[model samples]
Target: MKLRTWGFYFAEAWRGVVGNGLMSFASASTVALSLVALAAIVILGANLEHMTRMLEAQVQVVGYLKPDFDRRWSDLLVQKVRAIPHVTDVRFVTKEEALDRLRSELGPDSVLLQAAEDTSNPLPDTIEVWVDKPSQIPGVVRAMRESVTSLDSVDYQQEVVSRLAALTRAVRLAGAGFIALLLLAALFIIANTIRLTVFARRREIGIMKLVGATNGFIRWPFLLEGMLLGFVGSALAAAAAWAGYRWLAAQVALGLPFMPILRPDRVLLPLSEALVAFGVALGGAGSLLSLRRFLRV
Candidate 1:
């Protein structure tokens, strides 16, 4: 493809867009709306995935010891627990450390903290256990109870882990289906718009064929036109998505500072590039599909 040939394709594509301004606007607007929903889903899925990772990193099992439990076996117990499957390591939290933690949780002026300071600490020794994965919690907890004696209780956030896993799967599956539907609708509208443009230019197409122009030559301008339509829509969608996500992130930061969400600056650049590429691909696909029947001559 020479520069002049490319220039001609761009010129013709531009002419098509300008000649059928209403139809072009309709196609682009529909594409933008469809892509905006896709952007929302992508951003949401990203944040959910980030949160899941954070939780996974922090997830651990804690075992409380009975007050009468012997402290002499602490090192031996650590060794026995480390030998358990999926148990990475274990640590002993003495009553003093546990009291300090309690105070931290209850705050400096807390009545409970003042009383604990004045009276002998009744906080039990705690065993902090780390596992390789969240799924191993149940089995590991059971093993802990069986292997260790005078165990007060075994505690882990297995429910939280399970719920987050379920939610992430559901969001991704639903989002994927919805995105597919939106893309199909966008393709249908763009194809119809391109088909109309092709119909109006049928005479020119025939003349080009008569002059020995290849089907490729007749197709290039319409292909470019379709792509241009997608380009405009995707750009608009990306801009809107970036702005919306940035504002939402800021609001989340102010209202729910503990919540973990990706910064727009980190997320938007790649997201926008992906949307533009996806839009252009869809445009090319719509152009190809629409022209398949019309190119028989």
Candidate 2:
């Protein structure tokens, strides 16, 4: 198309928005509200998954050796533990090292450390095993028991890890479904918005058809009008979401430093881009779908 024709289309689209001021405002507001909800869920689901991964990393199995277990066999026991299915890595801690860790955990000024320095360390040699996933902990622990007779005890946070894994799955499933519903509602709302525009301009459309204008020519302006609404609403939503998330992140950092919320920079940029894209696409699709019935003129 020539620059002149493009200019004409844009002018017509702008007129469509400006002529029906109330409907345009309603359309943009609806789109903005829908996208705001979508953005919140996306940010929340991403942080929840991040926290799940952090918790997964901390899950480990510790196997303590019998008091009489020979120190020479430590290397052999480590190799056997590493060979177990689902075991990703293994580290052996000597009795002395364990005692030193306990001492440090007790702090430099603690009376417990003073007493421990003069006495024999009662801590045992232990093997720490890491797995790729939380669910594999039980199998790995069972394997450790059957394959290594020197194990005086085997332990891991089985209940907590299990619950966390289940919760992550539920959140992902629920978040995805809710996001889809919100987008669908946004799509239909855009369609309704365009329907109102088409209804208002029905006489103009019939006249254009009578004058031998092609359907494509008639379609371009409405399409642009829909996209314009989408762009305006999405821009507002992005700005609002960005500002809100930034404030929330700062507040969380100051008040609950231990929470694993993602930084705004890590999440907001991509989230804003995605919201804009989804909003525009939905508007274009909704417009295209609604114009079909009106185009019969």
Candidate 3:
């Protein structure tokens, strides 16, 4: 289309919005609210996924050696553990190092060390095994239990690992279902809003048809109007979501420093772009669908 024709379409769109001020506001508000909810879910799902991955990376299996197990065999044991399928790394922790770790954990209280100085260290040697992936941890642990006869105990945070895996799956499934619902709701609302606008202009539309104007020409203004509404609403939603996420991230940093929170730049930037694209697509689709019935006239 020519620049003048595009300009005319935009002007007509603006007039339509202004003419149906209340409906336009309602449509924009609906878009804003839907996009806001969608953005929140996206951010939350992303953060949860990040947290899950962090937890998985930290997962390890600690195999405690029997009390009488010879320290010289530590290297051999490490090699054997590393040979296990899916085991990515293995480190042997001596009894003495375990005692020192205990001391450090106990803080400045040297009394425990001083009392045990005369006695043989009761702390057992440990082999720390890291797997290629978190899901492999359980299998690796089972293999260790079966192959390492000298193991006094095999341990890992089984409960935490299982819960994290379950949580990740739940978040993904729930997020998908929720986003689908929101998209459908937004489509329906926008389509209904545009339908009302078309209904109100029925007489003008008939006159335009009588004057030999094509349906495409009549359709462009409403399409542009819907897209404009979606763009404005999504912009507002993105701004609000970004501010809210930053505030929440700061709060999490202060209150729960150990917890992993996704940075805004890494997550929000992509999310904002996605929201804008979604809004525009949904707006255009809704307008096109609503105009079908009117165009048949």
Give the number of the best model, judged by lDDT: 1
Best by TM-score: 1
Clashing pairs in 2: none
Error of model 1, residue 121, in angstroms: 7.1
- The residue-by-residue lDDT of candidate 3 on 1-297, one tens digit each, is 789989988997888788888877877787888899888888887887787777667637889999889888888888889999999889999989988888886655688886766688877888888888766878999889888889999888656867877887787788789778877877877788788878888888889899998899999988998898788778888888999999999999888877888998788898899888888888888899899877986
lDDT of each: 0.89, 0.85, 0.84
Off by over 4 Å in 1: 67-74, 94-124
For candidate 1, lDDT tens digit of each residue in 7-112? 9999989988888889989889888999999999999888888887777776389899999978998888888888899988789888999988777766689988
Query: Residue 208: error of model 3 in Å?
Result: 2.1
Shift of residue 104 alpha carbon in model 1, Å: 7.4
Give the Cα-based TM-score of candidate 3 against the true structure. Answer: 0.84
- Summed over model 3, clashes come to 0
